[model samples]
Structure formats: structure tokens, C-alpha cells
Target: MSQEQRLEEQMLSQEAERRLSEQLDGAEKIDVDVQTDLLKIFQGQADGVSVTGQGLVMRGIRVQDIKLQTDSVAVNPLSAIFGQVELNHPINSTARIVLTETDINHALTSDFVRSKMQNFELNVEGEIVCLQPQEIQIHLLANGKIGFTGKVLLKEKGNARPVSFTAQVCPRTKHKPIMLENFNCTQGEGISLEVVVALMQKVKQLVNLPYFEFDDVVLRVKNMEVQKGTVTLLVDAHVRQIPASASNS
Candidate 1:
């Protein structure tokens, strides 16, 4: 590459990193690699893009580490001149996310996640029951199983009762429904079989969604692994647009 070409690459890399940082709440470190040349920029194409980050927080959820790669991207040449990545068409990307045990526990307690868990309703024996998670902890185990211990308040007919349970979650293939196994009540009043069955069905439905869509992005899990102290997930994302600001906004 010529001197001018190298300089252009470096400038694009820095701008990519800055834009990625703007999309997150915070990060310990972020690196961006842009594979392109002046010729490709003039043609409104990028050879590829790779990003790596650690301790990244997005939308109040903290990730331990993440690596993302995109195939050739199509952009507007005008946007490139202003250091903006305006996609001309949807792009396909692969992402790997690593979450440590601590990250999981902290996310469970975060106000953003907790707010989503509060007052969750379930149908048990034709009665509308509200489930509010009070405390939850996750343990990554061997054999693709995750163990959880949590206390929840189950409100039925305006009366609330605390129920604590220990359970194991096992995910099958990407196409199969997640299995909730060995759910045992550890404290407080035990949950009934009917409620347990209902909860499991609810979990299966959520985990088996066709795709998770948000903010002009659609994500589908390609694979997942659970091991001691860590959980890792591989995802395929279809990006319609890149956010230029933090998720909270």
C-alpha cells in the first residue's frame, strides 16, 4: 500500500472505533480493523471489518468480551467522506460474546434486567399468576447445562408468596427448544407442578424465538456453549442500520 493508502486505512479504523464506542455505554478497551483502500471507498465498498472489545456495557448489560466480523460491506461513498458508516443494504455479520459468571450475576441484578423481570405474568391452572424475580444467580456447569437458584414472589389473586427454586437449563441444538430440567424448590413454599410446567413452557417459547429483533438489527443464535465459570454464544446478525448513539437514548 502507498503512504496515502495506509493513512486512509488508519483514519477509517479510528473512526470505526469511535463510532462503536458511541454505541455502547462504556468499555475498558475497543479495537477496530478496517480492511479497505481508496479504490474500494470510491466504489462504496469495504473489504471487511473486525472489532474486538472487553468489558463492554451496552444497554445496561455488561459483556466480558466480544469479537465481531463482517463480510464485504456496501456503503454510501458520500457517508464515507464524512466518516459515517451509512449502510446501503443489509449486512451479515458474525459475533461471539463471552460472559463470565460475575457478569451474569451482575446482569441479573441490574435495574434494566430486573425491571424486565418484574411483574411477569404466567398462567397456572387457568389463574393469572404474577412472577417477580427477587434474586437470581446463575452457575455455568459442564455438558452445556446452566444451573440457577432464584427467589421469586408469586402473586395469585392479589396475595403474594415467596418461592425459591433451583433449576438446571439445558439447551439443545440451535433448532431445538431449550429444556428446563430438575427444577426443585429449595426454600420458601414449593411451587406446584402446574406452575413449574407453565414456567418451562414460557421459557421454551422465548428461547426458541425465530429471531430477536431490535433497533434495525435482527439476531439469531448460531451456537452456544456453557462451561465452568463462563458462557459463550455465537450469533448471526443482520444489520439494517448502525446506531450512532448509546442504547439508552
Candidate 2:
């Protein structure tokens, strides 16, 4: 058959193929993965949130940049290569980039994670991604709305970049649902600023990951101030840095 004919048939088809193929052939299982909770990731709007967080993690430069600047060092005196001390090819060292809120934002569950779409509940919508310099922040509100704001800081590894970003997960309802709280940025590098913006735009087009496929999970990881295997979010709670059995005297 001609390619044009195939195309025409596909376009003119009255009904899309009815389950062209079935997994497990014709067999079916009664067991299904029922979500026990709802996953939430607050995307607060520009003027709707009050942001607050600390203890930033380090997201250094890309390995590729360091790899390319290995011999591009400044050679002094007679050691200068070719007398003029030109930067050699294939230098490897550090990656200089404007680490903005967008970098951290992209590394968020929004762009940080690359998996199937998951479940998420949000109260507000943040502004489109942006970049400035040295400071990266997001506009937030008490209603859980947020707008990404801030500037680029670190430009390379060993850049002594003290970076961190966080927010409190205030669920709309009394009971907080399964949420990707303590949310942090993930691997960021390998693209130019323009590319990052464009990629972020693509992410906007794609379905938000945590909306459709994520199941609510409430596992308790050890909090720094809490004992191992302990999960507490109360005053004098270990996770909250308060002893469970001991109180300030």
C-alpha cells in the first residue's frame, strides 16, 4: 500500500483502533494498584504564597565542563605553553552557570524527576520560570500559592555555592495528603540558559508528572533531629528537633 493511502486511512478512520493490542493477551487479573493517598506538590502563584526554607544542598557544575577545561589553566613564567600561554583544547575543570531559581525549579519534581506522571494536588499556579542573578526565590502566599523568583548565583563547581530551597506543605484540607514535600532540586546542567527556558516551556506543555500516575506515599524517613526510624511532626518531636520523651527544662 502507498504511504499516502495509509495516512489517509488513519485520518479517515471512523473509530480509533479498539484496543489494538492487549497486555497479558486475553487474561485479566482482579488485583489492581489502588492509590491509598493523594500525592501533592504545591505550585503556588506569584502573589499567593509565603516562601520559607533553609539548609540548601549543593548542585555543582556539570562534569562535562570540568572535563573540557583540564588544560586551560593559566601557566606562569617559562611553563607557559607556546610562550603565549594559550588555552589548550579539550579543557576540563568546572562548569560556570547562572544557578537561578529556575535551575532549582527545573530540578524540582516538575523537571527534576523523569518518570511517569504521578499524582499531585495544588492550590496555586506559579509564574513562568525566570532568572536574575545571585538570589533565587519564589513568591508565596499563605494559601499555598507560589511564583518562582530569584537570581543566578553559582556558576561553577568549587564555586562555593551555598544553595538550598524549600517550602512548608500546607495541605488545603486539615489532613495533608501524600505530598512530595521537602521538595528539592535535582540534577541540573548540560544546557544553556536559553535551552533551560525552552526545556521548561516543553515541561509546561507536558502533563504535570504527579497529577495522573503518582500514588500517595507516607513513608517516614529519618529526620536529622529525630532518632533513626522515627517520624514526628509535633512540638518537642524529634523531627521537629524536640525530644519525644524529653522537654526543655
Candidate 3:
């Protein structure tokens, strides 16, 4: 490649890395590599792109580490000249995402995730009950099982009480819902079996969602593996566009 072409390529790669870093809430490290040639650039195409990050937190969701590589990408040439990557077509990629036990627990308590678990209404024995989660923790166990312990505040008919429970979660395929193997009250009064089953069913529904969609990206997990202290997910990602930088937004 000519010196001018090499200089342009370097500039594009730098811009890509900068934009990617800006899209995250926080990260310990981030690297972006854009592969393209002058010919491909003029055609508004990239050979491929690879991204790797550690301690990435995006939209309040924490990820321990991630590696993603995309196929040929289509973008706008005009936008590329101005250091902006505007996609003209969606790009498909394979992603390997890793989360540690601590990452899982932190995400469980994060505002983004806790909002979905807190102050939910459940119908129990012909009575409307409100449930608020507190002190949730999860441990990645061996053999694809997760150990969970949590405290919850339950209100029924203006009466309130705290319940703490330990449970086992069995991870399954993407097509299937996670199974709640067992539940045992560790403190305070035991809850009704009916209420436990109802709560598990609600959790299963959330786990069985087809895909997770964000503003510019959609992800579907193809497989998951659980080992002691870590969980790894193989995922397919369809990205319509790179997320806009906070500064730009």
C-alpha cells in the first residue's frame, strides 16, 4: 500500500478504537482492529474487524472479558473520511463472552438488572402480593449448576416480612429455560411452594427470550458453559451500526 493509503488506514483504525471506548460506560482495557485496504475503503467495505475488551461495562451491564470478530462490513465512504463509521448494511459476527462469579453478582445488583427484579407483583393463592428483591448473590458452580442465595421482602394485605432462600439453578440450552432444581428457606418463615413455583416460572420466561436487543445490536446466545467461578457464552451478534459515542450523542 502507498504511504497515503497506510496513513488513512491507521487513522480509521484509531477512530474506530476511540469510538468503541466511548460507547462503553467503563473498561479496564479496549482494543479495536480494523482490517481494510485502499480498494476496500473506496468500495465502502472493510475486510473485517476485531474487538477485545476487559472489564467492560455497557449500559450498566458488566462483562469480565469479550472477544468479537465481524465478517466483511459495509459502511459509508463519506462517513469514513470524516472519522465516523456509518454502516450501510448490518454486519454479522461471532462473539465469545466471559463473566466471572463476581461479574455475575455485580450485574445482578446493578440498577439495569435489579429494576426488572424489584417491586414485582405476584398472584399467590388468590391474593396479590408484592415482592422486592434484596441482597441477591449467585455463585457459578461445577456441572452447569448455579448456587443462588437472596433475601426478599414480601408484602401481602398490608403485612410485610423478609424471606431468605437458597436455590440451585440448572443452565440449559438456548432454546430451553433454566431450571430451578430446589429451593430451601434459610431464614425467617418458609414461603408457600405455590409462590416459589410461580416465581420460578416467571424467571424461566425471562431466560427463554429469543434474543437480546439493544439500540444498534442484537445478540443471541448459541451455547453456554459453566465452570467453577466463570461462565462462558458463545453468541451470534447482528450489528446494524456501531453505538454512537456519548460525547457525540
Candidate 4:
């Protein structure tokens, strides 16, 4: 080949490589943004009392430290604009209930009562356990006795009825908070429970974060268990894409 022709070909190849590099960089940025948004949503949704005082605390898997491959992005067109992502880290979290006598009474009388059951009332004290990653177990004292009572009553001193439940997390909206769907107690013939939405809303309002929403991404609980007085959950979250305009804002 002529010298001039060889030089021209080299320049064209370099230009193509530069354009590809820029595209890859842009895709990575989008991936990071999506992951960051998901973490924010998780933190926001996690702000609530499962029992009282100490609620949920999400840890590990820093957003900035998350890494994504360019090839993963290339496979999905939406990922090119938003970023293809996967979270394989152990999600560590804690939920503890430490309340004063007054606080405990208020929680029992107001929050624990259901509108349908007027006669249903009881005092409870205990620690949450998360030794297993599939469910949250609770060993509490009912009326100072070891037991838990609800639609089904199981009571015994120092041998309280153990309550356990699993979580099903999902995204309810774009760039919003996630929801724990069908949280059912799997002990004493099993019973489904619902989180107090009003309380959650109040907690969110108190935080007053501007860009927070509800259920921005979907999550599947891979492992969950309780140890001592804390419940820990390991989850895999699926972060969906947010519109470019909305994300920018």
C-alpha cells in the first residue's frame, strides 16, 4: 500500500476507536446513575418501624463501588441509555426494637390494634432474629410471658411462640420507593401482615428528601434471618431505567 493511504487508514481507525470509547463511557455513567438511584430508593423505603424505635438499616454494597461491564450494556438497548446492571453482594441490614415503657404502650395500643378487632390487645417485648437468610424470626414475651398473640394465639413463659415471616420486595413506580409485598408470618398456622403505610409516610415526610419516590426498583429476598435482637436480609434487586429527563432533574 502507498504511504499516504496507510496513514489515512490509521487515522480513520483511531477516530472509530475514540467514538467507541465515548459510547462505552456514557453507558457506564448511566449504569452508575441507575444503581445510585436504586440505593436511594432502598434507603427511603427502609425508613419505618417494623416494631418500634429501631427499624430497618441497609448496609454494604456502596453505589459508587458498584461495577458494570460494557458488554452487558451492549446486549440490552435500554442498558445503552440506562445501563445494564446486576447486584451480587450480600445485603446486610438490621432491625431492632428498643422502646421505653411509655413508647411500648403507645405502640401496642395505637399501632398494633386493627380496626376490625376491638378486643384484640396485648403487650409484647422481645428481640428479632436473622440467623437464616430466608425468614425473620421473633422470640418475644407477651404480657411479660414468652408468647405472641394475634388472630391466632400462642403463649408460653420462656417458651414463647416463635413468629417468622419472609419478605417479597418489588418496585411500585419509577424512581420511587420499593414495597414489601405479602409479608406473612409463617408460624402458628401462618398469617399475613401489612406494614402501617401511614407510619411509613410520616417517617418519609420527616426525612424530607426531595428526589425520593416509592418502589423505584424490584427486589427479591435471597436470604434473611434473625440473630440476637436484629433481623438481617440479603436481597437481589432489579433496577429499572428512569427517563433521561427525569433522572437529570
Query: Cα RMSD (Å) per model?
Result: 2.9, 28.3, 2.8, 19.2
In the range 79-192, model 2's lDDT, one tens digit per residue, is 121111112221222212122333334444332242322322211133233322333344334344333333233333223232233332322222433232333323344424
For residues 65-163, what per-residue lDDT tens digits would candidate 4 score against the true structure?
122111111012233223222122222222212323332233344322222223222222232211111222223222221122223333323333444
Give the range where candidate 2 is weakest over 10 consecutive residues by summed lDDT.
40-49
What is the C-alpha local distance difference test score of each model? Answer: 0.80, 0.24, 0.81, 0.28
171 Cα displacement, candidate 2 (Å):
6.5
| Residue 223's lDDT in candidate 1 | 73
* TM-score of every candidate relative to the true structure: 0.86, 0.17, 0.84, 0.22
Worst 10 residues of 4 by lDDT: 45-54
Instruction: Please give the lDDT score at residue 115 for candidate 4.
Output: 28
Better of 2 and 4 by lDDT: 4
Cα deviation in Å at residue 182, candidate 3?
A: 2.4
TM-score of model 4 vs. true structure: 0.22
Candidate 2: misplaced stretches above 4 Å?
1-133, 154-236, 239-249
Residue 76 of model 4, lDDT score: 26
Q: How would you encode candidate 1's per-residue C-alpha lDDT over 1-249 as one tens digit per residue?
A: 898877777877887788779877899989998788888888899888898999999777889999999999897888776676667888899999899988889888778777666567898888998877788888988777888888888787888888887888785456665577777766656567888777767655654676777678898877778888888888898988766644335
